[model samples]
Target: METKARLVAAAREPLWERGYAATSPRAVLDATGAGQGSMYHHFRGKEDLARAAVDLNTDEMRAQVDTDLGGPGPALDRLHRYLRRERDVLRGCRFGGLAQDPEAMASPVLAPRVEEMFRWPVGRLAPVVREAQAACELRPGLDADRLAVAIAAGVQGGYVLARATRDPTVFDSAVDGIVALLDTARTEP
Candidate 1:
């Protein structure tokens, strides 16, 4: 990997583990084995490095989700595929879990990228919902945009619940419940 990319990748694990407040520039540098001059050469400071890492995570997430969402299947099928896809259930969604940390939400530079990472998936899913409604697979009254938002929230919340309780079953239950709700809602009446 490139030096900058290495820095970002190294930074990602610490940030995910310790979050914004606890993850210091020195920690990231030490983790990456990059000195101050090397880091400064690539990024302005910790915030800049965090933003780059956040963007990298966002892009990776978007690609993974888009692939699932656009896969060969019905919208709900694709949704289920994405929902139940193998994940580091223990670590949780990297970006999603970080957003809940007090420091992450407070950092002006870091917070927006984190928020955008979430908002992108919901935005992309909304269109699939509308298409499902148009095809008469979903109720005409179903609110695609809002439902997308709720589903997105459920996903993040599922990870949070799973991590807090250290139980994968909780995450599975949340996904199953949401999928059931969406399936039922999408069925032809």
Candidate 2:
């Protein structure tokens, strides 16, 4: 890839894995095998490069969510697809992991992106939930927005649980719990 693309790509893993506080610009440069001059030529500094990397990660994640939730199926099934979608459970979420990093959350550049990362998924999921409710697949009394937030939270929390326990099954169990809850919420046919 091009130098700028390479830098952003290389920065993403460290930023996700190490957080903004620990991921030095030099580490990114070393990973990309690019000189300091190339980094300077492409980005204003570490925060700027981090912003680009975060933006890329956000875009990729949003696209995947859109695909998973927008696919042809019942809204409930789509939601299940989203929850059970393949993920690197042990590695945790890129944006959710960054939110735990104080420096990342405090950065002007990173903060808004992180906030959007959380908000956007909820926004995307809410309508699908509402649709399920409309079709009588879910309880009519259910709060779509809150359920959407819970779904998003379950995935993020699952990642944390999995990472904390060093067991990917923890993540699966969390998802299964959410699935069971959803099934319980379904209207009796």
- The model with the greatest TM-score is 2
Candidate lDDT values, in order? 0.83, 0.94
Give RMSD to native, each candidate.
1.7, 0.7
Once model 1 is optimally superposed onto the true structure by TM-score, how far is the C-alpha of residue 82 displaced, in angstroms? 1.7
Error of 2 at 124 (Å): 0.7
For residues 1-189, write the lDDT of model 2, one tens digit per residue.
999999999999988888889999998899889999999999999999999999899889989999999999999999999999999998889987789899989888899999999999999999999999999999999999999999999999999999999999999999999999999999999
Q: Which residue pairs show backbone clashes in model 1?
A: none
Residue lDDT tens for model 1, 1-189: 777988999888877777777778887778778888999999988888888888888888888998988878777677788888887776888786567787788888888888888888999989888877777777879889999998888888888898899998888899999988987897656
lDDT of 1 at 105: 88
lDDT at residue 52 of model 1 (Cα atoms): 88
Candidate 1 structure lDDT: 0.83
